[model samples]
Target: MTEDARWLSGLEEQARARLAAPVFEYVAQGARDGQTASRAVDTWAAVEFHPHVLRDVTDVGLETELLGSPVGVPWGVAPSTLQRAIHPDGELAMARATAQAGGVMVVSSNAGTPFSLIGETGVRWWLQAYLPADRTLAVPMLDRAVAAGASAVVLTVDTPVVGTKYPVGRVVWDVVDPALLRVNFDKGTDERPGADKALDLGPHDVDWLAEHTGLPVVVKGVLRPDDAVRCVQAGARAVWVSNHGGRQLDRAVSTAAVLREVIAAVGEQAQVYVDGGVRSGLDVVAALSLGADAVFLGRLPLYALTDGEPGVARMHREVGAQVVETMRLSGCRTLADVAALHAPSAPNHP
Candidate 1:
């Protein structure tokens, strides 16, 4: 078998075995029956691609910019908690792979290695944060991310509370190692102190982050149209429509369904992105066709890491390869073409 195909399927089984029961479950399970989780894939599957007949296939480029920074491709690695559990390299492995593949990597607020420790190079870094109730704790983390050289900040708004994911006769949370799950650090250090300011994001908190950090601010986990509008008015440079992978709320709309509404709210003033159940190149196509500037992969990268750092690298390479092939076969020549191509959604739900 070709290296990509061999490694692709092999990682699933290896990941299933390497991860401790609890670690695997927490990463694998979705909320409730995990219907939303399953729906993530189904929704993408329902979007058909209409390939153009006469486009020149040679020299297609998948490059694009997220919040003004160049990225090799529109696809990226989403932030999840604790990288070390899956591999000794943890986020560093993923970070390196991101650089190697020429994609973006959004590091978690709770990253095991402080963002400063992970080098910024060929890959662009975006900071992913939870608006913690305690500003003292939150501010410093943001400060650290800034010091780490992050180009943008992604504020995850759906995690008012953590998620519960039960998958196929298993309560996934019960199996993951609790230690690895908490990637954020203990408070009382000298990073900064404005996390409490984010408890109920208003113009004050939002403006401070943008004005103080000088980083492009994007709000994540926003599913409502009004919320999207609020984020933009509050100075959001972009909006990332996510249900936290259906890991936080079971009833949230599929990421694909909400893309247009968020885009409409921002209406060219800001860019829009999506996460959750974005598993393949076709899935990437689905989100972009609907108007997402980009999409993030939270679970898939972690799943690959289960076999160690090399596994994660393998995953990014193969996935990047898949996305390139998908782009070529779809008859799109660039990220803009992917944005320009449109196909009607399937008549019925899968």
Candidate 2:
């Protein structure tokens, strides 16, 4: 195994040993039968690459832009909630680690840390939100995120309601302090009539968010090309191909399986980002090869956070190093070069 892979496995072992059974399960388990979650990693592994051998690879660059903002690497941390259950530092630790690595972070709407504190860390971040049944309830949080310096808004469109996971030994919400889950909202927000996830989400909601927040909106959880087209047409800056980490839909297609189609559908109208089963530097290159503008990590960083901030930093360093190595070995000098490596008939090909 590669060093990063081994190190990640070790961290997972450490986390399993240190965390409560339910907390670990909360981060680890997926929806019923876990079929989609189980297939994600292998689906990415199944992707084949045809590397160029003779090109000079001595100087490789990993820099790229997301929503027009520059990032040091092509991969960034994806948003996940209830991080405090894994570590005391929670979102602050993640922000610091991501800033140190020179990558962007997507902060969960249900984040344990305050928006201002996460912003204070100097990591470029975007806010991920679920529009409540009463859309007005989201205004305060969106305003707070913008005032806190969030670069963009990622609207997660997959969950009308939380999915049913196979019952764990213990549920995370029942065992952990409720205060750590949604510190960003008002005390009685959950009990309010409009606080539930909106079931009637439509393209108009995309337009409403952009008009309301005056920030670029990224429609996440899109698996179909038609859905991607609709999001971009509705003024989304990007469409994230995700299946909610296989937590929302058990049989949902893996991101790796639909990235090319989504990229093709959106074309240059907007950027395409993806998360789900991205585990290594090689996987990052593979996604880029398939036409993804950037890749995101969901569970990996959380697993690293078990060791606290420095552990997360180390995880970034390890993955970054692996990315550099993969670039050199594949004979790529830039992110654009990685896209060129795709086959002529590939959906991303011009």
Candidate 3:
């Protein structure tokens, strides 16, 4: 009930009440037996923060530079598709909210907005690509994203295949409603192919993506140290430790758990970021200490859009505030201090 408790508050509960059943499932999914979902949070439970009490902790600046670009916070929105499922405003609202929050918005490959429009949003943009098996298709998209003014292009290396989002697809199509559409994709016609299949049906090949695009590429959805090292060697500027919010592979380890290993592998050559079950401000601290340069949110902002863009904007503000408060309480002043806390546990959950 305290002011600092805002990040721990009930945005999800409110969103669940407002959104259609299927729409909720789209944002709030866990693959297979849901083991990964539980483990994602459990990893946080295992990470305990080692707070320093008496320091000259005065100014707390959450600002950090990412890939040489200045950002207001060490966190941003994860690339999530079908954002308009909960609000008609879709990427337009989300982009505005991200800009309003002074954070980056990694636009989805399966986005509601066209690549060009997102480019003009005047916000720092990164394109999150689900690489196609056919280099013919993948390269063109990367080219388009670069042409659209994407500063960095991230290849989502995990989702080689889309997992069974069962009850979500069925319930939404059969029960709730169809407010969402991948407008950016052409649903399989004689001439145009389904973008979903193009993005998913192919096996992953990092070489093509690396060789084709001149953009500073990143590899997202990486959990293995070897893969992280591979990505960086292949010209990636960063590695995003993620499990696709537990929507891709079930029983996969938590994003926070393997972050240190990946960071250690990439060492200082590539920056590290994470997303998956990030629920609070301290979680941000946990990620940074565990070797992440920044963190991303998957479902939290969608909950805000259920009410309106401002509602989602409010969530970003509260999360940032909680992050600052957590820093103050932990005797860490600024992101550098938070980065230095490296508690060897999930920012305090342990």
- Per-candidate RMSD, Å: 4.9, 2.7, 4.3
Candidate 3 or 2, higher TM-score: 2
- Residue-level lDDT tens digits of model 2 in 92-144: 99999999999999999999899999999999999999999999888888888
TM values, all candidates: 0.87, 0.96, 0.88
Which structure is stronger by lDDT: 2 or 3?
2
Give lDDT per model, in order.
0.75, 0.89, 0.75
Q: Against the true structure, candidate 3 has what lDDT?
A: 0.75
Model 1 agreement with the true structure over 1-350: per-residue lDDT tens digits:
13655566465566678877666766777887777877887888787676665777677787888888777878898888767777777888888878887888998876777576675543578888766555556666677777778898887777766666545544444544545533445554324454342446565556767876898888888898898898889998998898888787887789888788878888988988898887766688778887889888888888887666577677776776766777778777887777766764355767
Model 2: residue 256 alpha-carbon error in angstroms: 0.7
After superposition, which runs of candidate 2 have C-alpha atoms over 4 Å from their true positions? 1-5, 344-350
* Residue-level error in angstroms, candidate 3, position 47: 1.9
What is the TM-score of candidate 2?
Answer: 0.96
1 or 3, which is superior by TM-score?
3
Cα error, residue 182 of model 3, in Å, equals: 3.9
**Which pairs, if any, clash in model 3?**
47-345, 47-346, 48-345, 48-346, 49-348
Q: What is the C-alpha lDDT profile of model 3 across 250-315, one tens digit per residue? A: 988888778888988988898999998887777877887776899998887778878677877777
